[model samples]
Target: MQQEKMNRSLTLIPVVLFGFSFMALATVFSTYGVAAEISHGMVSGSYLLALIVMLFTAYSYGQMAKAVPSAGSAYAYTQKSISPYVGFMVGWAVLMDYLFIPMVNYLLFGIFFSAAFPAVPSYVWILGMLLLVTIVNVKGIKLATVANAFISLFSLLFILIFIGLSAKDILGGAGTGTIFNLEPFYNPEESFSYVVAGAALLCFSFLGFDSATAFAEETINPKKTIPRAVIIITLVGGAIFMTVSYFAHNVWPDYTTFTNADAASHEIITSVGGKTLASMFLAVYFVTVFGSAMSSQASASRVLFAMGRDGQLPKFFGKLHHKYQTPINNILLISVVSLLSLFLSLTLVASFINFGAFIAFISVNIAVIAYYFIRKKERSFKGTILYLILPSIGAILDLWLLLNLDIHSKVLGSIWFALGLIYLFFLTKGFKQRPPELHLGAAESS
Candidate 1:
């Protein structure tokens, strides 16, 4: 019997939910302190700047999704438009994002869950989350998407509550005590470099929008839906991040006074709503992280499936479940790898994930230029501006962010790339020919 294929059952709303969940509605709480410190309390401005940079990249992803609606995402875009060799390397780089992000999400869940229930080991929570996400993914895309949508809605509710409480506290003569203030956007003490550095880190919250493209093969009317979803998710997610960060900044205007820079939002939560609400916020935050992990695992499995089907990795990774029509092997692989969170430090894992994401962002931006301008010679003024000039700017911004990564991340990312190089050597038989290709069905170019 022939193996089952992924069900083309996902629509625009589910896609949007998947993207939103992957971005994680609770992201501000986890990263706000660091962003505030880096930008000298200009956390809102940093997120806005990062959103601008991400929008440009989102355009490239949108254009590419229309051009090549395949599950490989950046890999498919690069392979079809640029060289297959480059595509393989891009796929390798993106694998780091897909493979490790879920781990990060689960690691975060573990930490918070363990905190809530101190008697339980963190690793136990991690394992339990891993199991739940894996099972949801294996069941099918629709189930996973529904789970994400529900979790996303609850997460959004909690965020709105947090913002409302913060606003009320501000009105009650706390911190700035007024929503109208430019202090969160700028301060004389903060330099341009500091804001840019903060923006680089803030970009992490926007990472999941691109992963939406990985569902191309499983989306209904993918060429149109995936592109629109990519842009919409970015805009929506950016709005949430910016608004929350703005109020959060108002609640605690002094970055230097944070007891733990990494846990600044914790203090803000307690101040705004007391310990009970803070505890409730933590529980909701865990749910959001769980949603994030589920979305990440689903996306990562599809990328592995795409790569496997194209013969970049073992063909087994390409196989869909006989009954469920999901990427069973690849999903299982990701679950196994996510176990690394048990042993790895959160700081190292998060930094390395960002490194891979930045590299992949650079590749996707360049792929837009190479394919549309250089290869196709579609030099119409609009095409030139959108496909060439915009992506160039995105690439430059991504490069700047890449430079801002810590040395440890830079080194580890380099090592991952080196391993990819070694794998490519054997896969291509010493670079004598192109890598194997998978036939994508019914791709419509925009």
Candidate 2:
């Protein structure tokens, strides 16, 4: 029998919706407090800077997808454009992100729910979310697609409501007494470095937009559609983040006053909409958290499955459930790791995830230059700008952001990368041969 292939019926609209669902519009509020404090009330500036970094990387992904529309995403881009060895390392780095995102969502869910119902412990809420997401992944996450679409729509409505209420409060002389204030974007007393630092953390909020490239095999006219979708998603997500954050800062300019930075969005919501609206916000938040947790858990398991099948780990991780046709072992393993969130903080987890993301982003940016500028020799002025100058700047900015990450993220990320290096050393027998190429079709689930 012929091997099955992904269906090629997804058009631009569906593909764009997939990107939106992956990168949830509601995430802006999730990190609002931390970013506001870190940026010195300049959360909007941080998001704007992060958007510039992502746009450059987005262009590279688009170009690579146009040239090599494969299911591997960043892994495939580096493998075919650069080399298999570089590809393996990049894949490993991205795996760090897929591994931790579920935990981030779990922790966020716990933070919000526990605050609403102080009678219940946070861990209980976290445990419940993890158990639900694990079961959904163990069976299949196709149902998650429909659920995510609904959540995505509701999240937009949620954001719009917040924006309107925030504007109303501003009119009533709250915050800076104006809807648009330059002070929130750049406070004179604080160093501009604060904005850059906040941008590093805020990158996590923009994580899902590039996922459009993963659907190349399934999208109609992928060379065109996928590239457009990726660019549009990046811009749209960035705009939402910047706008929402701008309004958030104006509604509450005193970030330092937040009782708990991690759960600050809750306070802002209640203040803006009062008790009844705040209660409604809590319900919608639960669904948003549920959708994000389930999808993230599913993606993490798929990456583990891909690595196991390639012999990077024990084959047990590669094996699917006999009846469910899913990676049961990997799902369970990730669930166990997610339990760590109960002991961790939000900024730390967000930084940990970005450590790998920046590496992957830098690698993809370099991969573009290596593929087009050197191998293909596109030496014309336009080609030089697109393939050389632009990508180099992207790499530099990504490196800067990587360095800006808190010391803990760098330490942990270094340890994670070091482990990958040791594994590669043995797998390649001391770099005498090429590393094994990963089968990334299933791993690109998100």
Candidate 3:
């Protein structure tokens, strides 16, 4: 079999960065990030506090991405600053982080598509979206990038419209006369710790800033553009999320509006006006989920391809199509796994993919801390704590959440590990059989 390397032809300005943030918002928007800010009276001030934390961490990431634009993302960043073992774990943790995001978006797609087209089965929509993204990605990176750009544009417009419509309702006195009050902050029912936990959940929505870093090899002027993209996408995406979340609930200050166990998430935006606005919002929601899934599929495929080519995975997983110039095997694996995972979810057997994602986040954060600590910059203890300490604490909190995840999730995640380990074992053996001279090519290309 002939080797087919990835094309560095995908030179674009900060798209994957924007797409990452857009996808992240879509992933967590309907959940607590937007929901909490809207219904729980946590918008603006409290949400902004969460944003501050994200901004600091994102700045650190931006600096790192600029310094070393590579495929491994946190793994590469940490390795350069720390050790290869830390890099290995960061890579391991990212398997789920990158893989399950599409799963979350897939679930969101099923829900909103059901709302939009009541007659059709939700799983049908799920399957259709999966097939469509797979085909688009199977074409090549340039095509996938174009698709992502269009979807991201449409999705952004949709979010802005929802925010505008929600604002109209707020100003029109449609809200239940809750006097724009600051009383919620002092209410005994709410505590800072709960708020922090809520922020952690919300933080998930803002967690994809570094996603752009993974596409470093594909970007134009990456050393500069990639980092700028990270910051820009984070701020832009964060602004949209904060604005929507604040007003989504501001239009109806009562938490009861959305907290009901049977509440349709689509109702939050639709109830603001008439069926037209509601329908539009739902349409955007559908595309948002679709776009998120597509971007994630592309990212995941690249990671798998890179790993496979490096002799850290099965060689077949690394193969790029001779003509298409795409990672055909990697893309197929991602699409199949995602669809299978979706199938499991429909059967009520799918585990909590979010647990895997958060675990990856904690791993990345911890990796960053270790990297900074081992650097020979000779910085003071105070500087070290400011950058590294808080992030480590954040990782601990993330671990606590992962520990608290459902049994099915833990079980499935362990299964995922067993599979990875089996593959790793074969990968290790295969490397031992390769001629020493052949190994040099992988190193030089990498």
Best prediction by lDDT: 1
Q: Write the per-residue lDDT of candidate 3 for residues 1-446, one digit (tens) a residue.
A: 55444556545453553355335454434664344544356544445555766665566566566555666566566555555444444555566767777776777678767876799997888888888878987897677666667667777677777777766776678764443545333235676665565565565676567677777666666667776777777777777766665565566566654655234345675577577866666666676777777777777777666566655556886687888877778778877778764555532333544555665556556655655555534247875775577666656656776776667778777777666555545644743443111121322222
Between prediction 1 and prediction 3, the one with superior lDDT is 1
Compute the lDDT of residue 8 as modeled in candidate 3.
66
Tens digits of per-residue lDDT for model 2, 183-250 = 76777888999988888878777786666676565567888898898899899999999888888888
Question: For each candidate, how many residue pairs have backbone atoms clashing (under 3 Å)?
Answer: 0, 0, 1
Runs with alpha carbons beyond 4 Å of true place in candidate 2: 1-9, 135-142, 187-191, 256-260, 302-333, 339-351, 438-446
Q: Worst 10-residue stretch by lDDT in candidate 3?
A: 435-444
Candidate 1, 1-446: lDDT as tens digits: 34235778989999999999898878878899988888888888888898899999999999888888999899898888888998899899999888999999888888878877999999999999899999999999878877987898888888889888888888999998788998787777668777777888888889899989999988989989998999999999888888998998888888899999978888889988899888888778877888889888988898899888877899888898988889999899899999999999998887678788888889889989988999888799998898899999999989988897889889999999999999999999999978986566556473
Judged by lDDT against the true structure, how good is candidate 1? 0.87
Q: How many backbone clashes does candidate 3 have?
A: 1
- TM, every model: 0.96, 0.87, 0.81
Better of 1 and 2 by TM-score: 1
Instruction: Pick the winner on lDDT between candidates 2 and 3.
Output: 2
Question: Given candidate 3, what's the lDDT at residue 294?
Answer: 74
lDDT at 436, model 1: 80
